[model samples]
Target chain A: MSNKAKHWEKTKGQMIITMILWFFFGYVIFMFGENINSASFLGYPLAYYMCAQGSIIAFVVILFWSAGRQEKIDEEFGFTEKEDD
Target chain B: MFKGKFIDNLPKIYGTYTGGFLVFIILMAIAESAGMTKETIGILFVAFTVCIYAFIGWLSRTVQVDAYYVAGRQVPTVFNGMATAADWMSGASFVAMAGGIYFGGYTYMAFLVGWTGGYILVSSLLAPYLRKFGCYTVPDFIGTRYGGNFARFCAVCVLTLASFTYVTAQINATGTIAARALQIPFELGVWVGLISILLCSMLGGMRAVTWTQVAQYIVLIIAYLIPIFWISNKGGYGLFPHLMLGEEVARLGELEAQFGLVKNSAAAVKEAGVPGGLKSISLPHSEVPAGGMAAWKFISLALCMMVGTASLPHILMRYFTTPSVKAARKSVCWSLFFIALLYTSAPMLATLSKLSLMDPTLPTGIIGKEISAVMAIDWVSAWTAQKQAFIADFNGDGILQLNEWFMRGDVVVLSTPEIAGLPYVISGLVAAGGMAAAMSTADGLILAIANALSHDIYFKIIDPKADVRKRLIVARSLLVVIGAFGAYIASMRITGILGAVAWAFDFAMSGLFFPLVLGVWWKRATRQGAIAGMITGLGSGTAYLIYVYPKFMGNPAWLGIDHLRFGIIGASVCLIVMVVVSLMTPAPDSATQKMIDEVRIPSGKTILGKQH
Candidate 1:
C-alpha cells in the first residue's frame, strides 16, 4: 500500500510536469519555426539557444528532478534496499 | 574508495588484462595494415575496456541464478542506470548516430526524438508491468500474462522478426567499421564482426553480454568524444568553451562578406557537388527543398524512433534483467543521460562541419586536387566501362563538380576526423569504437533470437519434454545459425549502416511497440487484441515501406520512403488496433489482474515482500 502511494506521489507529479514541458517545448519549436527570436534569457538568441542548447538543459533538469523525487519517495516509504544512506 | 574492491579482486582482474592484450594485438595489426600509427592510444583503450568488462564479470559472478538474470531484486538506482546506458548505446546509437548528424544536417535530429521518445512508452507504460511478472523475455511475459501458447508464439514471432532485423543492421555497421578501420575487404570485415560477436557473447551468456556492454558504454563514449574534440579544436573551437558558443559559426559568418558578421559566426552548410560555391547560411528550404523534409515528415520520423526504441526486444530484455520496477525506471534515466552526451554532440558536429565546408579555400586533404579529380573521373569511367554505374552531372557542365561530392552518411564520423586533418590515431580509435558498438549489439540481438527460437519456441511448445540443459544447447546452436544468417543478410543489403538501421527501428515501432505498451499498461488488453495489433501494424508498416512510401516520395514505385516515417505510421496502427480489439475482447482474468497490480505496486511493497 505504501509502495503504491509513494509511486503515485512521485509519478503523478512527474507525469504532469513532463506533459507541461513537452507542450512548452512544442511551443518553442513552433516559435522558432515562426522565426520569432524573442529577447535573450542570458544574452543569447532565445530561439537559437532554445532549439540547440535549451532542450538539452531542460532534459537534464527534468531527469534530475524526477530521479531525485523518486529517490526521496522511495526513502520515505522504505522501498529502497541499497546499503549506505 | 577503490581499495577494498581493488585488493579483493586484483588477481582475477589482472588475469582479464590478458584478453586486453589479445584485443590490442587484433587492433594493432589492423592499424598497422591501414598505415595507422596509434599503437599507444589503441593499447590504452583496449586496456580500459577489458578492465571494465572484468569488473562487470566479477560483480555478476557474485550473484545467484535469479540475481544473474535480474540482479536478485535488489539493484539500486545508480548501478541500474549504468547498465541501462550500456543497453541503450548498442551499436547504432554509439557509432552511427553522430554520422547521421554529420552527414544529414539539422533534419537528422528527428532520429534523436524517435529513439528517446520510444523509451517514454517503455518506462511509463510497459516496464513496470514486465517487472511485476518477473519474466525473462518479452515472449515469457506474453505467454504468462495471456495464459496461452498461441500468444507466446505470436510474441516469439515478433521478437524474432524485430531482433533479426536489428541484428543484421548491426552486422552491416560492424562490417563497415571493420573494413574502413582495418583496411580489409568487406567480406573479411563481416567475418571479423561474426567472430568477435560469437566469442564475446558465447562465453558467459547474458552475464558476459551485460558486463561487456557496460564496459563498451565507457569505451564508445570516450571514443565518440575524442573525435568531436579534435574537430572542434582544428576548427578553432576549444573543448568546453566553444561548445557553449561555436568558433566555427563565428568563422563562417566572418569569411562570407554577404552575411557580414553573421558570415563568420553562423555555420555554412554546403552540398558536396554544388558548383555555385558556398552559401552564407543554409538557404531556406525554398532553396534546398530536397535537402529538408516537411515538418510533418520530421515529426513522424521522430515519433517512429520514439516508438521503435520502446518496442525493440533486445532493449526491452535489458529492463527484464534489472531487479525491480524502480530499478528499471532508474536505468532509463541513466540511458538517456549517457545517450544525450552523444546525441547533443551529433548536431553540433554537423553544424560545425557545414560551416567549415563552406570555406572556398577549405583544405580537401587531397595531395594534388586537380590531378586527383582527373584521376577519380577516369577511375569512375573505367569502372563504369566494366559495370554500369550511376553519376549525375548536376551542373550542365560535363565536369564533376568538386562540391558535388556526396559522402555516404555512414562515413560521416570516419570522414569528419579526416576532414579536419586530425591525427590518424583519433580516426583509428573512432573506427574501433564503431566496431565495438556494432559487435556488442550484434551479439546481444543474436542471443535474443537464439533464445526466442530455442527457449521460447522449440522447448516451450514443440518439445515440452526438453530439459533445461538440452534447451541451453539448442540456444547455443541457434546462436551460431543466427549469427551466420545475419552475415549473409548483411552481405546482400547495399543500404548504408544508419539508413538500414532506421528500418530496424520502423519494424520495432510498428510491430511490437503498441502491443508491448498496451499489453502491459491497459487492463482490457487481450491476446486476440495483441495478435491482431502486431500482425496488422507490422504488415501495414512493411507494405507502406515497400510500396506506398516510394509513391509518396514521387519516386519509381519500388524505392521506399525513408524508413523512419513508416515507423510512426506503423506504431499508430498497432496502437489503434490494440485499443479497438481490447474493447471488443474480454478483459484479462483475476490472475492477470493480480500480476498487473503487483507490477504497479510501489517499491515499498517490494521491500515488504523481502521482509516476508
Candidate 2:
C-alpha cells in the first residue's frame, strides 16, 4: 500500500474508535434508569455497582489506554514533529 | 546587602503559603478546643490537611513557568485525572451533592449522569483539538481561529459570566463549611479559602492549580470515603443497599407508633392534620420519589448536569496543559475516574442514611403497639443513653417521634462522620478536603478571570503595544483584585453556594459550549453564526435566570418556571439560533481554514509526513 493509503487507514481507525465510544455512551444512558445492581456478576448488582462506581473506573482506564494508543499511532504515521518549528 | 535583597522579596512570594498554613493551624486549634474529639487527634488531622497544601506549594515552585502554567505540557493521563478530579469537584460536588442525593433520591441521580458522562463528549469532541492548537486560554483559540478581536471579547464576556458568579458561591460554601467544621465565624472561612487561592493561583497559573488540585482530590476522596465506610460498617449493610432502604424504614416505623396509629387505626393528628401511620408527611421519607414536580423536572435536571460538566471554564482549561491532543483526551477519562470515586459514593451515603432512618431495630427502630408515646421515650432513654439526637417526643408523648434531623440538607456530608460516630481525625480531613475543593476551583477561576482581564482585555485591546513582561505584571495584579472581589461577594451570602456553581455551568452550556463545540467539530460553523448563538444563549439565559429566579427559589412567580430547569431552556434557544445562523452565513476564510487544518493535525508531527 502507498503511504497515503496508510494514513487513510489510520484516520479510519481513529474515526471507528470515536464512534464506538459514542455508541457505548448511548447504551450506558439507556440502561441508566434501570437497577444497576440487579445486572449482577457473582450475585452483585453489576449495573448498580458500575453506575455507582464501575463506570467511573472504566472511564479512567479507557482514557489512559486510548491516550497511549493515539500517541503511538501518531508516531507510527510519521506525524511526530520536533519543537524547533 | 545580599540578605536584605533576598529577605525583602521573599516575604511577598513565599509567606503567602506560610501565612496560609499558620492560619490553617490556628483554625484547627480552635476546632479542637471548641468541640473536636480527643484534641490531639483533631490537631493531627488539621496538620495532615495543611501538609497536603504545603506539598502542593512545593511542587508548584519546582516546575518552570511553562510547567507552572500548563504542567510543562507533559503530565501523564492518570495523574492528570487526579488533578482534574480536584479541579472539577468544587464545593458543590464535595459538600452539597451528598445532601442532594440524601434528600432528592432518583431526581438527584441526574448529577452523576451529567457530570461523569460529559467527559466522554469533551474527550472525544473537544479536548484533543484544543490541545493541538496550543492556546493559553479558551479565548485564544477563538481569536486565532477566527482572525478577529471581536471573538476574543465575546469569549471573555461568556467566561466572566460563567465564572464570577460561580466563584463567589464557592467562597460562600467554603466559609460555611469551615465555620461549621472548624467552629469559626463564616467570614473567617471565606478569608482562609481566599488567601489560599491567592497564594497558589497568583504565583503559578494552571500548573499551580493542577498540583494543588491533585492534592485536594486525595484529601477529598479520603475525607468522603472514610466516613461512608465507617458508617456502613457500624450500620451492618453494604454501601448502596442500606442507603437506599435501611434508614428510610427505621424512621417510618418510629413515626408511625408515636402518632398512636395502633391505638386508633384510622386516626389523623388532632391539629396538624397529618395522618397517623405510614403515610405521614410530617416526617422525612427515605426518598422524595416525586418531589412535587412532573417528569419535566427530571429531564431538565438531567440535561443541566450533562451539559454543565462540559461547560465549566476551570475544567475546560485543563485541556490546554497537555502536550498533545491525545494527552488531553486521556486526561478527561482520568478526570472522570477520579470524580467517579466520590460521585458514586455520594448517592450511596444518602441511601444509607435513609435506610438507617427506616431500620426498625433499636433507637431508630419500630415502636411496639402498647408503648404509647410516653413509654416509648422512657424505653429509648433507658436503652440508649443519649446517642439518639434525631428523636423528639412532642405533645408530652412517651414514644420517640421523628423531628427534624437538626442537620440542614447542606450539612449532610459534613455531618455524616459525626452522625456515624467516626473519629474527629476523619472529620477534620473531610473539612480540609471541602476547603481544598472550593479553593482550587476558585483559584482556577480567578486565574482565568485575571488572565482574560490582563492578557485578553488590557494588554491585548486597551494597550496593544504592551510588552509580554508588562502583561504578566498586569495579570498578577488583577488576580489579587478579582480574588478579593469573589471573597467579598461570598461573604454577602448571595445564594446557596452549590446552586450558584451549577448556575454557572448552565450559563456556559448555553453561551459558550455550543459555539466552541460547533466551531471545532464542524467545518460549516461561521463567525456570524457563533456571535448570534452567543447572544441568544447569554441573553435568554441571563433574562430567564433573573426573571424566573424568584419563582424557582420559591418567591412570587414571574412567568411561572423553576430556576433549576431554566438552563435547558437557554441551551435549547442557543442551539437553535446557532444552526439557523450558520446556514445563512459564509464559511470561514482560507486563513481560518488553514488554522483549523493545523489544529486537526496530530501533535509532534506534520500531517504531510515531512519535517516542518
Candidates' TM-scores?
0.79, 0.78
Q: For residue B286, what is the lDDT in candidate 1?
A: 11
The complex in candidate 2 yields a DockQ of: 0.30
Residue A34 accuracy (lDDT) in model 1: 28
Q: Write the per-residue lDDT of candidate 1 for residues B301-357, one digit (tens) a residue.
A: 665666677777777777766656666766777766776776666656655555554
lDDT of 2 by residue, B1-612 (tens): 234542244335334544554465456657766885644544455445645665565556532435544655766566677778887788888878877765554555556666776776677567787777776677766666655778788888988988897889877876776565555688887886677677666666666677676666666776788778877767766555423433433444344445433221233333333322112123222222332343345445655766776776677778777656666776787788778788878867765554454344534333322234423444233322423122323344454334312234555676566545565556676777777787777777887788777766886678988765566678778889988888888888767665676788788887888888877666677887787888888888877877767545345434334576567767888889988898898888887766665666665442222110
Q: Which candidate is the best by DockQ?
A: 2
TM-score of chain A of each: 0.64, 0.61
Considering the two chains of model 1, state its CAPRI-style docking category.
Answer: acceptable
DockQ of each: 0.28, 0.30
Best by lDDT: 2
